[model samples]
Target: MNKTLIVATLALTLGTTAADAKTRLLVNCFWPSSHFACSEVLPAWIDEVERVTEGRVTGIIPPKSVAPPPDQVAAVQKGIADVSVMFNGFFGESVTGPLVAMQPFVGSNSAEAMSRALWRTNREFFADEIDTVQLLSQFVISPAELYSQTDTPMNSIEDLAGRKMWVLPGPLAEIAKKLGSGVVSSPAVSSNEIISRGVVDGHLGLDPQAVQAFQLMPYTKSTTAFSTPIYSTSFSVFANSDKWAELSPEDQEAIMSVSGEALAAAFGARWDKAAAAAVAAYPEAGIEVVEADPAFEAALTEAAAFVTEGWLKAAADAGMDGQGVLDFYTSQLAQ
Candidate 1:
């Protein structure tokens, strides 16, 4: 073969190899495409990943294709998808300790603090607690506060008590009970059907965008919070262990770089921003705003103790040092 023929062949081979070397990952998440968690965070994450990978990795997220957000983890675990985002709270009856995010006053307003602690805990504690699959990172939801309709103000435990209140199952209701409020397990209902029907007076949730997405806040008249927030929600990004193993070392490292605490904080900030936007919309939306009365706040803290006890017990059952996990989480936040 002549020099020209050899050079031509080499160029073609190199071009093909460059393109083939690119790694492609399909990510699945439960949030609707419009939701910031999905639209902003995930899309921004893909961009960051691509930029950091220097074109060696690319991602695809079929916005609406992932189905119910609650089932995202199952889809990934079943190999229906390669990666997914899931909530420990959503795991339902199984009782994974990290879902403790559902309990009030357990988290702070700093997403970075919560994320790093959660990531660390996953390696040391959650690893044994959750054996179903692999965890990339854990993140906290924005904030959990009380949002009520205009007719009534949640001024004190007495104001909240004797009133029909909406609470998510698992850990959140300990506060409502302490406040002497009737617990109603229907956030979805409050977000849609129940609020419109006047079944409950208030809803507890964070991520202002979440309320907007569900359109539940439109019916709410007021929100009660410390401004710094009492607690935050938590969730994680994950991959199917089997599929994760199939990737090359370079690919794994590239993905891992995007995991851990930093990502958690970044995700957390987005929630804060979203929540702030929702809070600002209160007056325009005909929603009222009130500080949680001291009595009610005190009662809330007292009731939350039970949730901690329950979590510690559950963690012990799962072979973890609940106090250690709690200490790590709380200490990391202070740092």
Candidate 2:
């Protein structure tokens, strides 16, 4: 071969090798495209991953969720998608440590603060709990509140007992059941069906943003606010373990730099802004808000005490000092 021909061949080979080296992640968003988790949070994180890796690491979210919310973890594990988020509630016995964030009356009203605190708590205590995937970050939405669609407000245990309620599954559902409310439990995404049809007289598990996102405002007449939130939903962002292992060490480190607590904070901040906007629109929406009476708050707390007790037992069975971890998480939120 001529010298010029040989040089050109070498250049072509190098370009092909570099192209093959790039890793493009398939990130799946289970929420609707307009939802912040899909529209903003996941996209922003993907942008940062691409930026920090200098184009070596990049990701694209599918136009629609690759699987239903409950099936997300399994889909990722099977390599159907490279990345996704799952609600911890759906995992049931498979997940325990993260339930600390879900304990009734434990989490803060600020999603950002609760998210960052959950991440720190996970690192300090529950690091080994989630071993199925490459854990990226953990986040909690703003606390869930009790909303009544009837003429009566959920001011006391008796009011709650009289109404049939739709509740977000898991701890909130369990709490409602224990309170003797006629409970219809399902995923938050499906709340519209039951509420719009008047299948339930009240709802027990949605933040302000969720009220707007899920279109629950029209059916909701009033919300009884507690001194602390009744519960919050916890979620995990993760990558398929095999796909994660395929990345170079440098690229992996770059991704982590933009994830972990940083990603949690970003998600939480978006939630706070959206919740604030929804709450600000309440008056025009004709939604009434009333603070829980002090006596009523204490009574509700007493009724919901079993949720924490159940979690503590599960945590202890898993060899975790459940109360210690809970105390640590709450202390972080206080800061």
Q: For candidate 1, lDDT tens digit of each residue in 177-235?
A: 66678777754424577666778877765445667767876687777766346667788
lDDT of 1: 0.71
TM-score of each: 0.86, 0.95
Ten residues in a row with the worst lDDT in model 2?
Answer: 88-97
| Clash totals in order | 8, 0
lDDT of 1 at 46: 78
TM-score of 1: 0.86
Q: Listing every candidate in turn, what is its Cα RMSD in Å to the true structure after a full C-alpha superposition? A: 3.2, 1.8
Q: Which candidate is the best by TM-score?
A: 2
* C-alpha-based local distance difference test score of model 2: 0.90
